[model samples]
Each structure stands twice: as structure tokens, then as C-alpha cells.
Target: MEDVKDYEIKALKKQIFISNLKAWIIGIILVAEIIFIGSFFSKMGTFGEESLSENKVAVVRYNQEVTEEFTTTIMERMDEIKEDETYKSVLFIMGSPGGSPTASEELSEYLKAFQKEMPITMYVDSIAASGGYYIASSIKPLIANKNAIVGSIGVIMPHYNFGQLAKTVGS
Candidate 1:
């Protein structure tokens, strides 16, 4: 009876040790992942408060599709830039296929307001078409590379009659 109790105690102790080790490993991995992601986004010009306080040119990257959420984020960033006097100018780097027209208009208006306060240099490194170009055009000194596409600048509201097409196809 005494020997059996000792064996069970040893088994339980080993299981607890293994569980603790696994938890530590997972915690370390999670911390490492957070650090990696933080560094990655920081490189893409996601400025920290410390960086914003310094005397540096503010960079606003608009690479993703223009939506209301993204437009709001941009507006917030612009407001930050306006508040920070250390920022002498802004570099707006754009690469987008364009998105919501309303969002683009909102961004354009925000940019126009920001430009009035400080200089903004718009750089279209890659494709900036339609709504993207519309927003970019609002800012002065817009620059684009030779190979960079900067046109297809118009809005369209398509009204598709799918029911007629289905009837014609005898669906």
C-alpha cells in the first residue's frame, strides 16, 4: 500500500511539471510573436508616441483599400500630425486599386485640410487608380514613377439587370 501511494505521487508530480513547462513555452512563443509583429508594423511607418514627439517627417502609408475604417484611421493620424509641431511635413505614400467613393472623398477632404496646415508630398509608387488617384490629386506636388499606373480616374455606378440576362439565357 505504501509503495503504490509513492508511485501515484511521483506520476502526479511529473504531470504537473510537464504542464508547467508547456505553458512557459507557449507564453514565450506568444511574446516573441507580438514583438515580431510590432516591429514589422513599426517599419511600415506606424509611428509610436515617442516617434511622433521627435523632429521627423510624418509618413502616412495608404496602401490598403480605402474604406470608412481606414479613412477614419487616416483622419486620426492627420489630426496627430497637425497637433505635433515637430512634424515639418508629411509624405503620403500610396498604392491602391481604389475602393469606396465616399471613403475616398472623405480622405481627400481630410488631406486637403491637412495640406493647408503643412506641406504634403504625395508619392504614388505603384498603382493608384480611380478613387486612389482622386485622393492623391487633391494634394500638391504629387509624384509618380515612370512605370507607376496613376490613371483610370473616374466613378461608375453600374446597374446590372441580371434578371433579363437569366431570362435570355433560359435559366
Candidate 2:
């Protein structure tokens, strides 16, 4: 009976040890993945301009569909940059299909005004079509990636006539 109990205790200890080892391995993998992803995004310019240092390039990452929200966020970022003497020029990292042509035009005007104070440049990494180009066009000497798409300068007004379909279906 004593020997059986010793064997059982040893098995339990081995199981617990195996469980802890597995957990540690998983944790290490998770940490490694996070580090790798962070490095990739860091090279891609990430999203925040707060990290820009004094006398360095101030980056405004706009990666959303152009809308009132985009306008508000970018305008606020511009205002913040205006006060900071830490940047010489503004680098806009734009990527979007864009929205609301009027808003884009308005934002373009605002960016133009801001450019009057400090030089503004745009770097379109991904899709910056439609209203996106509208805003980007306002920037003088716009810089873009070799494969970056810069087209579809137009507007979309989603209008549907489902009434005819409903009538035909006799709902």
C-alpha cells in the first residue's frame, strides 16, 4: 500500500509539472508574437503622432474612411502639432476609400490652411481613392509608395428603389 501511494503521488507531481511547463511555453510564444507584431507596425508608422520627438517628423496616421470623425480627429491632431515645436513638417499617412465629398473638401481646406503654417505631405500606403484623393490633392508635393493606389476621385450617394421590387413581389 505504501508503494502504491508513492507511485500515485509521483504521477500527480509529474502531471502538475507538465501543466506548468505547457503554460510557460504558451506564455513565451504569446510574448514573442506581440513583439513581432509591434515591430511590424512600428516600421509601418503605426497610428499615433504623440511619439514624434522634437525636431523630428510629425506623423498623422489617417487610416479610416473620411468622415466627420476623421475630420475631427485629424483637425485636433493638427492643432496639437501646431503647438508643438517638435516637428518641422507634417507627414500624413492616409489609407481609405474615403467618404462624404463635401467633408473631404472641407477637410482639404483646413489642411491647406494648416499647410500655410507648416509644410504638409501625404504618404498613401494603401487605398486612398475617392474623397481620400480629394483631401490628399490639397497637399503640395504629395509623396506616395511605389505601388500605392491614388484614384477613384468621385462621390457615392447610396440611393435605392426597393419600392418597385416590393410591388413586383406583391408583399
Index of the highest-lDDT prediction: 1
- Compared with the true structure, all predictions reach lDDT values of 0.87, 0.84
lDDT of 1 by residue, 96-130 (tens): 88999999998999889878889999999997998
Largest TM-score belongs to which candidate? 1
Tell how far residue 87 is off in model 1, in angstroms. 0.5
What value of lDDT does candidate 2 attain over all alpha carbons?
0.84
- Superposition error at 131 for model 1 (Å): 0.7
Residue 51 in model 1: shift from native, Å? 7.5
> How badly does each model clash, as a count of residue pairs?
0, 0
Off by over 4 Å in 2: 1-53, 157-171
What TM-score goes with each of the models? 0.62, 0.60
TM-score for candidate 2, please give it.
0.60
